[model samples]
Target chain A: MHPAPSVIVFTVLSGLGFGLLSFLGLGLPQVTGWEAFFYFALAFALAVGGLVASTFHLGNPQRALKAFTQWKTSWLSREAWLSSLALVAMGLYAFAAVFLDISAGLLGWLGAALSVATVVATSMIYAQLMTVPRWNHWLTPLHLLTLSLAGGAILAQQSAVALALLVVAGIVQILHWVLGDRRFEERGHTIESATGLGDIGAARLFEPPHTGTNYLLKEMVHVVGRKHAQKLRVIAFVFMIVLPIAVLILLPQGIVSAALAILCYLIGTFASRWLFFAEAEHVVGLYYGARSAQAVAG
Target chain B: MTQLPETSEKKLGLVIDLDTCVGCHACVTACKGWNTENYGAPLSDMDAYGSNPSGTFLNRVHSYEVEPRAGGCSQTVHFPKSCLHCDDAPCVTVCPTGASYKRQEDGIVLVEEDACIGCGLCAWACPYGARELDLAAGVMKKCTLCVDRIYNENLPEEDRIPACVRTCPAGARHFGDLGDPSSEVSMLVAERGGFDLMPEQGTQPTNKYLPPRPKDQLPDMDVLSPALEPVAGEPKGFLKWLDKALEAI
Candidate 1:
């Protein structure tokens, strides 16, 4: 699993954006007039900008419209549709709140539900991949959802709720890492099973198919050192959860403290998201004999 | 549609013989050559002939050393891999663009290049690493099983099979309707004890691989003792004279 920069940015920013939008839809902070306009603008920029950034990784962005057609089977398709619907519903809600000086009550609730669903859809894009054992877990969606809500609560200035959600997100993040570490081996994919040669003996890759790198090796066989990953995990936990909690609790309640907390949380979330993709071991690596017992154990 | 058909009319796939493959990569070459020119998009290479070359290949031959558990000797097995065209092809169902689909008619999974968004979800879904995103074409590529030539009536009847199967010098590759129990491939699988790769993955792969036969077995004979017998209990001509001369010296 290559920790593609574009995908990382998309998931992180969009998760935050949708989380913020969900809070806004519920009239958290209950901003009106210019304040409502400012919040909506910020939300739209983050959400739409993340969506645009996602297209950067696509080989053919021109044909991305076709991506919306396969929601019945594809999680990516569902994410696209859900995100678009969320944005549209939020846009209408924003227009009413900003211009008409009224809360489009039913529409705002619908938008909030869609916003959260969009984040779930995004998580499913990775969770549904059975080939990547680490991502194929019920905890994957739970981790993303918790992070989204926690980030949303912080942005909405719901300090008490944000503090609790942040604590839950931190616990879920640790649990995800602990369980995900064993998933590849637990899936029972090894060089022996991959090649169907365990009956003969222990199999090792004698010669690779090509001398040069291929797409599979480049994309799925990415190796992240265990020590480096461990350091990043601590950094992520501190910034995303601990620092935000400390800022909200210790510092006097002010816009400046909330801004600082948001900045710390975003940085931490980005680091964790990078690990999410980097640490994932796709089963295909077993065939290449790249994911050995030591690699899995790490 | 990205949704898989309930049942394919025919399970058309390859039966690879691990015993026979010499790791020549001839099938790989033939597949790349034929597919680039004939398929929806030409398979592309990035930084080719440079430091760090990479390309999209539908088929590749990997070699593995299997050490016998009984401790006789290690054997090198050449494993040629490509799309298994699984009955439960995960790649097909994961395609967001509906570009990837399995043909209900022939059971050959294919990527409709025009509709492809190049999101690469299909490639991620495949456990075999069967699908590769064509870097230049910006579309997914996989072993089509030579769909173009297999069904082309214009080609000579003998040349109708997949390019890999036809080009395999060792006859390691076989192509047929595995859905039909009476088919040559199905019978070959049954006779040779052919098995699927990663059966636990439960792809129910249409492709089958016949395991390699045991190697390095020898009869109970002291081969060196016969040579040590020294015909007629003496060294022959030159050897006999040399022995006498050496003894005198």
Candidate 2:
């Protein structure tokens, strides 16, 4: 819940990158030779760059190779495996299209599926956390997937498809916020339940464990002002969804429009992703006398 | 390797008495002292003696004021919290590096410092906030339940327990196998009605907490009214003599 800069960048950039990769794998633009090379280069830069950015937050980036071993139970591990597989598959497909001038039909489809799966796996890293009530919802994955596809469609120059997906993404975002706000109360965690003192009486924090802050307080207990969050939500919606849709409808389809659309979408997604972490209410904060997510949302 | 065993042979955990804890934080200090020296990584502090000091600690004590709903005096409950070492520990399964694992033998959840990638996903998965990321070491640190001391043959037999349990001044901390029905801890839990923290989370924590006893129950009385009541119809011995002398004057 720290709204860590590394994480925000990682999720937004990677989501967009993978979205574009999925489209390219499906031969959405159907370009060959140098034109195909340029698109592939852009996709790889975003995808690989985002992956590298993710490691920046790790305390021990040197040991990150060990992260691939626990894919059986860990979503983070699954994400590592999935992203690697997606990259390799997409790499082969890109090589065939750009250099060999071949479609590599089956490989392209496989790469596309893996690319989307990688994004889902990334989303699961947050969605699987029951500790954060705002993120532990079905809508979390749905929201991310919709945004990724919408961004992908724009990059692929599919204006009609992009417009529809953008509308859907906007709906999912609203639904995510509306339902996520109520999740903490529905989960029924409170200071009393947190301390097992509900049967006796109402409990309030009389004294903290220490005079200064500790790791838990720093990592899990983030406070975002409601007014500020609301403003950001509006900004995200207007730029990420409304503007992209408006541009595709009004401006002539060209490289200039696509660039403007991509830029606006990235800015909006970055803001939304920041809110994603900042607004998440981890149940651990209940022990420190933080109000539940429902109360904070109010 | 991150997958937990179906069942651990023993559920080793602590039973904390809320009634007896004086909020002294002695256990907290003792835990830090013992763990920093003995564990995989020394708990590091940044700006320890300077402004804005912060450090990694395995255990912490929090105090809360509980106002009974039945309308009695409020009570302060000193809560000493650390790793619960849950039977269904989310931390272990969430570890991407296979560093966080629960021992099948003793049910002690531990972090293998060597294997740790310091990704911190385990810390996020834990609802209790038990695991902490060591800033200097870039690895996770948690309550090992003094695994080093408890099993070390060098220590005295009486010292074969968690540092917090051994050092608790009020004897409020109890460490034992909670899995066995006949264990002292299980019996104590049965008698005192010990309860788990955040049962809704379904972590199924091995640790238990004994709720504080009820306070401030007494019958109403008027001490001043009894004192003001007339002892005699006229007066007592000293007052009678004074009244008679006054009448003569």
Candidate 3:
């Protein structure tokens, strides 16, 4: 749970891009001509760029193609397949709208549904992890969906819906943190239970497995300080929620202010996403003495 | 392709005795030595001879201090951890490619390095912290349970077990068909109350760990403890004389 930059960028940018495409596929804002072309092109570029960035995090990027074949069991594979379907459908829709000057109705609806499905699949990738108790909740998918919609609504310049959804997204974010905070302790597995030594007395780690950091320690045992996390939460709230709502309400309704709100929301989402990974406590960490009396407050 | 089989034919696994392990780390070293040579990528080391040395290891021994209970002395428990090869392995299900899988024939979990994208999701899904992503090879690595050694017809029958089990100095490691009720390991489990590491996780791990028996009830504790009964006036006069004579001699 290192919160690698590639993943943060992938989720944020792709979420925004797909959000925009979803709205456009539904024929929102009633725009046409070069302006429509520009919007479609920008959305495509963002989605594709975010996806391309994802491969940089992989050790064997060349073998990523094989990931598409295991859809029966792997959510990652399902994401790959659904995203491909969404991209292809959106591409055809874009071509018809810009070049042929005719966006077919069936293709438009199919593209929109696929776009939404792609985002859902992406969310499922993290939500399905039972090892990370904080993420193993139904609210994870809701958080992803609402945030994407809020971002999407802002991009489409639908002032009323964006403002309303932004407020909802903020509340959902706070609720998610509150619930996730309690998940670790609610899970009964502790060092005593993990080692099956509770029948005896207290169990304390006398020696770690190694002197230096290994792969498991580096990847799974990420710990964030409570004070720092609180500060980051405040920052995320101000940018993701307060600033966007303020700008949309106080500032004039136009492209410039809307763009600023979107930027702030994106930054806020990035911070929250970072916390998502940083705060997750993998059950394996119990073996490494990660649990303490106050572990729940983390 | 990453979906698990409905059932494995032979649930071959290790039954480790926590009481006997001395934290010698012989199994750790032997596993690294055998695996790096035989069937998988080299257990690569980074900055090995430098200020901070780190490396990939399939098995690791963790020592814990357990507080005394029931008038017993505090004990050091050497816990050797690796892949449990669970029946419901999340690692296999989470693999995007078919690289990470549990063998249907023998219940051995393996990583097919050739097909691996090295995304490291399998490592994240495993609660036992068994899998390690090899930085140099750009693929995930784990305890194969020494599949090559265990199944190799070339090796002597006595040596046909995992390298860790073979190298344990205390003879604490037992490997056999856990599926068979009559197997030695199953009987040991039944007798000693062998348990999984984290039963709540619901991984249904094939491996079982025999808990260290309570020290207070140990049959030899009375013999080991010092006793103070004077030999001079034990039974009678003749015995006393004999005891004194023996002591003087």
Candidate 4:
């Protein structure tokens, strides 16, 4: 809910970085020379920077070490574990490709698989939250994966592949938006269910727990105006998908055009991520008498 | 460590009566007063005595108006909400560090403050809004069910209950082991047809709420129809002559 800036940056940047690493791992079109070094540097910067940025959101960042110990049950721990593996493997693969001037096939494959797993683990962190019905669906992980692939393709300068994946990502984005809006109501929880008053009568919130905002209202029950959400969705779609596609199709394959597309895609993805958090309606909101599920939808 | 025990020896939880709660908020204040100092960290207030005064509270009472569909009179219900300490608690399982856990002995869910990294995931996992993040202490806090007092050997036996339960003016709150079939709370639940909150969420909450009993039926309007028969003769009384005398004057 709060859509903290650090988390947004972490998700988007890490997705792009891992996506790029996934492409390089496959050795698609035989990357070599200074190009390989450039790709490796960009991937490291995005992935490590994003991971480090995530720590800023923690209340006690120093105690985060214990987070790795609970991998048996916590997806957050799993993400940390997988990201470590991915980064370590990717580092070795980069050392071989850039310094030794040799293609490490096994290391590349391991790096690629772990990179993808890391993103999946990241998605699972949110997707596993049954309290937030919007993020509880399989569509959440699907959306995250598609975005990673699309962003990765763009960064890797794979025009044909990028265009194809971008279209797919765009379609998933629209579908997720359409579906996520109706998710809360589909769960069939009402004030009656929330308070266990279904057997007695129609229950409605007469008085809130407090006169002022509490942590639940501030964190879990964030309200975004419908009109503002719609406007943002359109802007997100235009910049994230439509403009990137337009730039790729209209301009020649070069550094300038690629950078432009990447910039627009990042901006668009950020807006879309913001909506992902903003539009999400936690089931706890039923106690607060939030408007109908359809109204909360983007 | 987050994995719940197969069976806890005791399921200590609160059973609140919807029929008797008066919405006085005594339990809320009582909880705040006791817990602010009992737990390791104080439940800090950000703007106390200021324009926007607010503080972290483990228990909060929410009042609702229930309009009966069967033409019964609308009733005001005061619902006090806190941690359910479910058999399968999502909050405990979602903790990245083994900080949030349910005790095996008493089934009381608690956060190990020393180990808690304060990621706030447990707060998100709770659908009941029972968990509150203490911004000042940089850790999550919640209803400990007066863990400090309930098992404190120093306290008087009668005063060992949770502060909320002890302070309830209407005696609407009951604290006992719901796991024991012979317990007073379990018998009360069986007799009153008590129900769990958000059963659909499948938390298997230890907390139970006894619904209000049906109201008594009122007399039909037709039963009083004969009383409205014309008081044909307001005559004969001394007051009748008084009206005529006033008119003549």
Q: Number of the top candidate by DockQ? A: 2
Residues B1-249, candidate 3: write the lDDT tens digits: 689999997999999999999999999999999999988778899899999889999999998889866556788899999999999999999899899889999999999999999899999989899999999998999999899988899999988999999999899999999988899999999999999988888999999999988775555556734566454546568877897889999
Error of 3 at A118 (Å): 1.5
Candidates sorted on TM-score, descending: 2, 1, 4, 3
TM-score of chain B of each: 0.91, 0.95, 0.87, 0.90
Local distance difference test, each candidate: 0.91, 0.91, 0.87, 0.88
- Give each prediction's DockQ, rounded to 2 decimals: 0.80, 0.90, 0.69, 0.75
Query: Residue B222 of candidate 1: its Cα lDDT?
Result: 92
| Best model per TM-score | 2
Cα lDDT of model 2 by residue, A119-214, tens digit = 999999899998998899889998999999899889888898889999999999999988998999999989998999999989988888888988
Inter-residue clash pairs, candidate 3: none
lDDT of 1 by residue, B58-138 (tens): 999999999999877899999999999999999998889899999999889999889998988899999999999989988
At residue A43, candidate 1 shows an lDDT of 85
Candidate 2 per-residue lDDT, tens place, B38-110, comes to 8799999978999899999999999999999999789899999999999999999989999999999999999
Per-model TM-score versus the true fold: 0.95, 0.97, 0.93, 0.94
Per-residue error for A20 in candidate 1, Å, reads 0.8
Instruction: Give the least accurate 10-residue stretch of model 4 chain A, judged by summed lDDT.
Output: A289-298
Model 4, A146-262: lDDT tens digits are 899888888888889999999999998998999888887898777899998878778888888899988888788888554588889999999999999999999998888889999
Instruction: List the candidate numbers ranked by lDDT, top first.
Output: 1, 2, 4, 3
